[model samples]
Target: MDQKQVRQRIEEIIDNNAIGILSTVENNKPYARYMTFLNKDKTMYTPTSRETYKVEEIDKNSNVHVLLGYQGEGFGDEYVEVTGTASIRDDKELIEDLWTDELDNWFDGKDDPKLIFLEIKPEYVRLMNGRGEPPHSLDL
Candidate 1:
């Protein structure tokens, strides 16, 4: 697929799948965890607490990886591998915008002092195992 087409596909996958694996580097090793994400204009955001280990790791290294979009029905299931830079976002407006009731399990509310987000801006993204096609890169 061309860049535009690949981008559209990438966006579709991200928009469709809110659950993704977010990986960060910790002590020169990879640490990954499932996260609920929200995106706007191809950038990803995941809510977390300011006290989380991932936040500390991100402070040391901005590079991150995200994998989303596979449904586990086996082969031909398309997925995305996202490589990006992560930065902490504590903006109250952003927190309010991405907030969901489910987050109550973790935070008291959107106004919780510990509430924060990891804003991941894609640097490279690849569409993997797409239907009837080889992998394609959404060149930034």
Candidate 2:
């Protein structure tokens, strides 16, 4: 698929899914965790605590992988994988803009200094359709 198509597909997947499995490297080992994410203007946002292991891991190694899709019992086969470098942002305005009641489930309504936002600028993405064989990839 073309760049535009890839972008659109990624947007669609992210829009449909709120949770993603984010993979990061820690202590020279791989770590994966489920996280709620939001996408805006092709950028992925994940709110987390600064004290979280995943946050520390990302600080040590910016390279990260994100998988967003629906995997139900005998359901659709849609999936999207995004690989990129992530950075921690402490901008209060950005954090407030992305904040919602749903986030209270994680941070318990605490937006302290420990609260941080991870901005993932995707460098590559692979999108798969339902029961498809060949997947479409885009390198940005």
Candidate 3:
């Protein structure tokens, strides 16, 4: 596929998938956890508490990796690998836009003091198992 087509496909994958693994560097070691992600354009957002370890890790090192889009049905499952920088965001507009009822499981509500969002801006993105083609990078 051409660059534009490939980008659209990748964005489709991002939009279709809600769960992913978010990896952060902690104590010079890799720490990974499952996170529910939301994408706007090509950027990804995952909400979390301000006091969480991942937030602390991102504060020290902005670099992060995300594994998303895989639906574990069979050998040909497609997935996206993301290399990016993460930052904390608490903008009221963004919070309102990305808010979901499921997040109530974590925070008291959108107004909760602990509520925060991690915004990931991709420096690199790769699409794997792309309809029998070899894995390739998507230029940002």
All candidates: TM-score: 0.94, 0.87, 0.94
Q: What order do candidates take by TM-score, descending?
A: 1, 3, 2
In candidate 1, position 67 carries an lDDT of 98
Whole-model Cα lDDT of every candidate shown, in order: 0.93, 0.85, 0.91
Q: Which stretches of candidate 2 lie over 4 Å from their true place?
A: 1-3, 73-76, 108-110
RMSD of candidate 1 to true structure, Å = 1.1
User: Which has the better lDDT: candidate 1, or candidate 3?
Assistant: 1
Residues 30-119, candidate 1, lDDT per residue (tens digit)? Answer: 999999999987789999999999999999999999999999977889999999999999998888788989999999998899999999
Model 1 TM-score is 0.94
For every model shown, the clashing-pair count is 0, 0, 0
Q: Candidate 3 — worst ten consecutive residues by lDDT sum? A: 1-10
Please give, for residues 33-63, the per-residue lDDT of candidate 3 as tens digits.
9999999877899999999999999999999
Q: Please state every model's RMSD to the true fold in angstroms.
A: 1.1, 2.1, 1.2
Error of 2 at 28 (Å): 2.6
Looking at model 1, report the run of 10 residues with the lowest lDDT sum: 130-139
Pairs with backbone N, CA or C atoms under 3 Å apart (clashes), candidate 2: none
| Candidate 2 per-residue C-alpha lDDT over 44-126 given as tens digits, one digit per residue, 9 for 90 to 100 | 99998889888889888999999998676343477898999999998878988888987777675646667788999999888
